[model samples]
Target: MATKTAARASVESNRNDDDEPESIPAPGAKRHHFLDPRRATGRLFVATAVGIVATCFAPVHLDWRIRAVLGWDTGALCLLVLAWNILVRSCPNETQRRAGAEDPGRNLIWAVTVLASLFSLFAAVFVLRKVRAWTGFEGQLWTGLALLAVVLSWLVTHTLYTFRYAHLYYRGGRADGLDFPKDQKPADIDFAYFAFTIGMCFQVSDVVVSCTRVRRAVLVHSLISFVYNTTILSLALNVAFNLLGDG
Candidate 1:
C-alpha cells in the first residue's frame, strides 16, 4: 500500500509540473518595434537623390538637347518610385509588411529590365539615323520593334516583382510589409487599399509612356518608370480585386 501511494504521489507531482506554465520572456527583454516611417522615408529620399545624380552623370552618345529632356524624365521617374516606396513603407498594411520581409528578387529582374531599356535606347538612336535617311519614318518596322522591346522588358521586370509581392503576401499577410495590427480599425485597411490602387495606376502609366517614346534616353526612362509603376499597380490591383471578391 505504501509503494502504491508513493507511485501515485510521484505521478501526481509530474502531472502538476506538466500543467505549470512555461517561463515567458520578460516584457522588458522583448525587442522594441523597429519599423519607423521617418527612417524609411529618409532612406527613400537618399535613394532618389542618388538616382538623380547618377542619371545626370550617366554618359550617353545622344545630343545635349535629347540628354537634357530625357535626363529630367529619368530623374523624375526615379524620384517618383523612391517616394512611392517610402510611402509604402510609411503606411504599410499587413500584406505589405509580409512582402517586405521576403527576398525582393531584384537582381535578375533589374538586369533584364536594364538590358531591355538599353536595347530600346539603342534602337531609338538607330531610329533617329533612319529618320534622317528616310523621308517618312512612320511605317518603319524598327520603330515597332523598339516599342515592343521596351514593353516586353518592362513587363518582365513588372512580372518578377509582382510574383515576389504575391509570395510575400502569401507568407506574411501583407503586400508592402506593414502588417495590420491586431486591433487595427477597418478605416485604416480601406486607406491602405486605396493607396495601393493609386500606386498601380502610376505603374500602368509608366508602361504606356515607355512604349510611345522614340528617343533612346526617353525610352530608357520610360522603361524604368514602367517597371516600377507596373509592379506597384499590379500588386495593389490584385489585393483590391481579392478583397472585393471576398466581400
Candidate 2:
C-alpha cells in the first residue's frame, strides 16, 4: 500500500514538470503562430506591395486588369488574416499557449513598421505635389498608388500595435496589465477593436489601460495614428481641391 502511494505521487510530479515548460515558452516561439503580426500582417503587406509594384510596370491596356487582380488578392488575404484571428481566439488551447509569452521579434517589428509609416507619409506628400505635373491618366494612376500605399501603411501600423498590446497585456498578466470591461483576458480581436479606435478616434474607447508600460504604448500609438490620420485627411482635401481646379 505504501509503495503504491509513493509511486502515484512520483508520477503526478513528473506530469507537472512536463507541463511547466509550456507556461513560459522558449524565445521566438510566439512568432511561429499564424496570427502573429510578423507572420500574418508582414506577409500580407509584402504581397500587396508586390502586386502594386507589378501593376505599375504593366502596360496601359493591362493596367486595369492588374489592379483588379491586386484588389482581389489584397482583399482575400485580409479576410484570411481576420478569419485566422477569430479561429485562434475560439480555441482555448491555442490562446492559452499564446498568452503570457515573450515576443523576441518585437524590436525588429517596431523598426519595420515605423519605417513603413514614414515612407507612406513622404510618398503621399510627394505624389500630391507631383501629380499636377503628371497630367491626365498618369496623374490619376499616381494618386491611386499613393492612396493604396497610405491605406496599407495605416493597416500595417494598427495591426502590429494591436498584437503588441495583446503581448504586453498577457506578459503583464492580470495584475499589472490592461483591464478589459468584463473578461480577465480578452481575445486578439478585442485588442484589434481597441487599436483601431485609437487609430481613428485617438482615444481608448472601452478598455481601461492599467499600467505605465501599457500607457506608454498607448501614447506612442495615439501619436502615430494622429499624424497618419491627419495627413491622410489633409491629402484627401487637397486632392479634392486639385480635381475641382482641374475641372
Candidate 3:
C-alpha cells in the first residue's frame, strides 16, 4: 500500500509539471526614440528664452562703438547654427562605415544646415560691414577684426568637415532619395532665414558668456546683442515701410 501511494504521488507530480506553460522570452526590448520634433523645438524655445532674459536684465547699451563688435558676434552664432544643420543633413559613406552610423536621413539634414550656416555667416559679415559704415563706428575696429578671426576659424573647421562628409556621400555608392525641395519665395526666404540665424547668434553668444563662468560678461553681452538686433530689425522694418509706401 505504501509503494502504491508513492507511485501515485510521482505520477501526480509529473502531470503537474506537464500542465505548466513553457517559459518564452519577452519580445526584444523596444528601442528608445531619441529625436523628436517637439522635444527639439522645446529646447530651442528654452534656449531663446534664457538668452532674452539675460539680455533684458543686463545693463548694456547698443552704442555705435559696440555695434561692429555685436555684429561680428551675431555672425559667428549664425555660422554655428548653419554648420550644425548641415552636420545633421549630410549622408556620407564613411559615416555608414563607422560603428553606429544609423539614420542617413538625419545626417543629410545636418549637412544642409552646415552649408546654410556658412552662407549665413558670409551674409552677416556683409550686412555688418554695411551697418558699421552706416553708423560711423570707427572705435570698434579691433573688436570687428577679432570677430572676423573667430568666424574664419569656424569656417576653416566647417570646410574640413564638409569636404570629408561630402566625399563620403558621393563615394559611398548608395541610392539617392527624394532631393530636398526649395520652398517659399526667394526674398521672403532670405529675410526669414537671416532673421532666425541672427536670433540664434544672440543665443549662442549668451551660452558662451555663461560658460566662461563670468556672470557679468554674459549678462552684458546678452543685453548688447538683444538691443543691437532690436535696433537693426526696427531700422530694417522702417526701410521696408518707406520702400513699400513709395511703391
Candidate 4:
C-alpha cells in the first residue's frame, strides 16, 4: 500500500509540473476542451521557446545569426509564466528536507539573475557594438521614444510587483510558504533592478559622450548606449504583456 501510494503521488506531481500555466484547470474541474484559449496561449509560449532554441543555431552550411528580438521576447515571457506558476500553484506539504535545509533552486535562480545582469553591462560595451554597426540608429525619433517608454514601463512593473511580494511575505508568508495571488518571485526584483541599471548607464554614457571631446571615449559611449537601448527595445514588447495579465 505504501509503495502504491508513493507511486501515485509521484505521478500526480509530474502531471502538475507538466501542465502549462494557463492550461491547468481549477481543482475538481473537468478536463479542458479543445480550442481552449488558455491551452493555446500555453502552447504559444512553448513554441516561442522552441523557436528561440532553433533560431539560435544554424545548419552547418548556413550562416544565420540569432534573432535578438525573438530571444529577448521569449525570455521576458518565460519570467511572467514562472511568476504565475509559483504564485498560483501549490507545493507538496511533505517535502523532503535537505541537509542544512537549503533551497537550491532559489539560490540558483538569484545567482543566474545577478550574473545575467552583470553580463548585460559588459556585453553592452562590446558584443552589441557590431549589431549597431549593421543597423545604425539613423536618428529615428520615434524609435528612440519607444525604447525609452519600454524602460520606464519595466521599471514601473518591477517596482509594483516587488512591493506586493514584500507585503505578502511580511504578512506571515502565504499558505504555500512562498506564493500568493498576484505575488512574484524575488527574481523579478532583480530583473527590475537590472532594467534600471541599463537605463541609468545609457543616460550617463550619453552625458559623458556629449561633454567629452575625446573621439575614442565618444565611440565607447555610443556602444554602451546602443547596447542598453537595444536590449530595452528587444524586451519591451513581451514585458508589456505582463501588464495585461490578470495576475
**Can you give the TM-score per candidate against the true fold?**
0.31, 0.65, 0.25, 0.29
Candidate 2 stretches greater than 4 Å from native = 1-93, 102-106, 172-176
How many angstroms is residue 217 displaced in model 1 relative to the true structure, after the best TM-score fit? Answer: 24
Model 1 worst lDDT window (10 residues):
205-214
What TM-score should be assigned to candidate 4?
A: 0.29
**Top candidate, metric lDDT:** 2
Worst 10 residues of 4 by lDDT: 93-102
On TM-score, the candidate that comes out on top is 2
Residue 176 shift from truth in candidate 3, angstroms: 11
Residue-wise lDDT of candidate 2 within 1-247, one digit each (tens)? Answer: 9999999999986664332122244233454554444454445555556556665655667446335434533543463465356434543334434545643245645675676567566656766676677678867776776666667667767776766676665552322356777665467677778888999999998788876667877888898788878876577567767766876
Number of the candidate with higher TM-score, 1 or 3: 1
Error of 4 at 144 (Å): 8.6
How well is each residue in 40-155 modelled by candidate 1, as lDDT tens digits? 23333453465467557755764443344344345334534543453344433433343334333445445545654564455444444444343334424333443343444444
Assess the local accuracy of residue 169 in candidate 4 as a C-alpha lDDT between 0 and 100: 25
Candidate 4 Cα errors over 4 Å, as ranges:
1-51, 57-69, 81-106, 126-128, 135-247
RMSD of each candidate relative to the true structure:
20.8, 9.7, 20.6, 17.9
Assess candidate 4 and give its lDDT.
0.35
Model 3 CA lDDT for position 22: 28
> Please, what are the lDDT tens digits per residue for candidate 4 over residues 7-81?
999998766433311212223333333323223233335534654774474344422322433344344445445
Score each candidate by Cα lDDT: 0.39, 0.61, 0.36, 0.35
